[model samples]
Target: MATAAATIPKDLSRLEAQAAGVLSPEALAYILAGAGDAGTTRANAAAFRRWKIKPRKGRRPRKVDLSTTILGTRMPAPVLFAPVGVQTLAHPEGDLATARAAAELGLTYLHSTQAAYKMEDVAAANGDGSRWYQLYWPTDDELTKSFLRRAKAAGYTHLVITLDTTLLGWRPRDLDRGYSPFLENKGIANYTSDPVFQRKLVAPANVAPLPAGIIFSGVFQNPGLSWDQLPLIRSSWDGPILLKGIQSPLDAKLAVEHKIDGIIVSNHGGRQVDGAIASLDALRPIVKAVGNELPVLFDSGIRTGRDVFKALALGADAVLVGRPYLYGLALGGQAGTHTVMQRLVDELETEVRKAGRRSHRSLSRSSLIRTP
Candidate 1:
């Protein structure tokens, strides 16, 4: 009889292929497109190939230990689900289904600020599983405070402040499709539930109908946010806080000075600044700058178990996968997400054994070699 684990899909690329089949061309392109020339996206993948792993000979590998602890929480693997909003476009169940899959897999799932379901609903789906909330930092101070309070109350253990997206990127795919999910009220969960957002509307004297599309436009941008305001966020939350878009070493040093718990080396998956350094290329210097003072997590261009291993070897304590699992969700909703997670875990286990390492601690800088 086939074991339960054996029945799950073993190839992540297969999930990607399935996603390609299922998702509309516009949806697929919207999620996959990078800003401007898209050179950074291609560069991210190429950087991984430049580094080659040097395997040892005459070593016997018996068991692999993939379990790791991040931000004081134990996870079965070093992979975390990166936040992707407006999942409803791919599936009816949306973020709720993705949350359930993450909970079952013992991995951390970061819920996006622009999620389809409300934070509380995603939390309910998580049901005691480790979760982190990503915040967009609204332009209004009161509104930002309200969101922070609600996220904490909703059981999010970590607060990921996304510093990358002050405005939407010039995504040609989305622009060509004339697709703006926000304008259609697709990924506006936090906005709809916000108290300050609610206040913008003039309620009828005797319970009259609300005005048309007035609430969304009022709470969209935060032009005045500067580094000075970060302290207010720190004051509001009593949990681990991470600054998510640090690509430069100097910024990494500044984040450490702020006493933030962690920093994610990201380029918003190449969706923010065109021609920004590929995140993988930027990881080494940032890790060196922090110099063991803070935990550095990496994202962008992480698609396979080999990529995960390479990231760990390159000083990333953990890695966040964005489009790969989104592909999974698009292909089969909850089951698809589970399949993608399992394939990644399996590949990591296999690679760990092949590398002749017993645990993550043993696989360090010495375990990797750069391709000439």
Candidate 2:
């Protein structure tokens, strides 16, 4: 259905540019915008350029094992679809298309709390795929619990609590265009479907998008959220709980102190802070701090398979690709998303072979050298 009008790009590098031709001005700006000046976004790509992969001599194995397990969830490759909200902005199928693609590819798909479709619908499409739910941690406790319960019931195996977006960042592009998807009620399906959330509404979300959107923005995040309150979530969720938006070694230690399952080193893809440290630059220290106590996943500025290789070499157990796959969705819907992600995995494997590595486990800090 997605590929009917357009031929999906195989090169992958040309995805965003091609997608620009297809996306509306508003959708394009919202999807591509970074906070403030987008300096951190630029740094994300620049950080990857600072590392040079060191190919081994005559030690390449004939076969590479890209498969791995994250907190007991098995994935065919080290790549995961980072939780991207409002996918409907890019494709009509939205999370459903991505979920089906992830299921078919045997990769993990992290569904966002701000998803365009309700959790159950995406799960139905996912059909027992390795899926995780990324939470925005609403101010209302019941709403938070309701979201987790829905996710668990729908077969999502993990919980990723995004700590950065307690308040939406000052994105200049969106502001310049006087656009906000939430205001348009574009990504409120999860909330609109929630029983707890409904009690707070005067009218059904579908019937009252404007009002529902206003309430969503108000309750979307808890600025007062603290480490001590993590147990509230842990008690509600039985699966592995990973804290997304972790950028500091001190915070990584704190996650260990809180007995969290894992930490994703991300700056919310540079969408939250304009001058924040690049996620890749932050990975090595966070990995060093946490060691093997918890899995360290990475996202932000991961544009290609080589970027994935760089992340693993820097000690990330696995990596998540966000914008790249969304670009795929923008261009070809499910097939486009699949093609982009598959290309990443394929390129990652090719990079491993070229770098004389045999397995994701074989990658280490020695496999790369920091460029001056």
Assess every candidate by TM-score: 0.92, 0.97
Q: Cα deviation in Å at residue 184, candidate 1?
A: 1.0
Separately for all candidates shown, the number of backbone clashes (residues 3 or more apart, or on different chains) is 1, 0
* Model 2 Cα lDDT, one tens digit per residue, 185-298: 888889988999899999987788889889988998678999878878978999989999999999999999989899999998899988889989899889989967999999
Model 2, residue 18: C-alpha shift (Å) = 1.6
lDDT of 1 by residue, 160-263 (tens): 98888777678887888877777666788677766677677576212422341345555555656678988789789999999898899999998888788999
What TM-score quantifies how close candidate 1 is to the native fold? 0.92
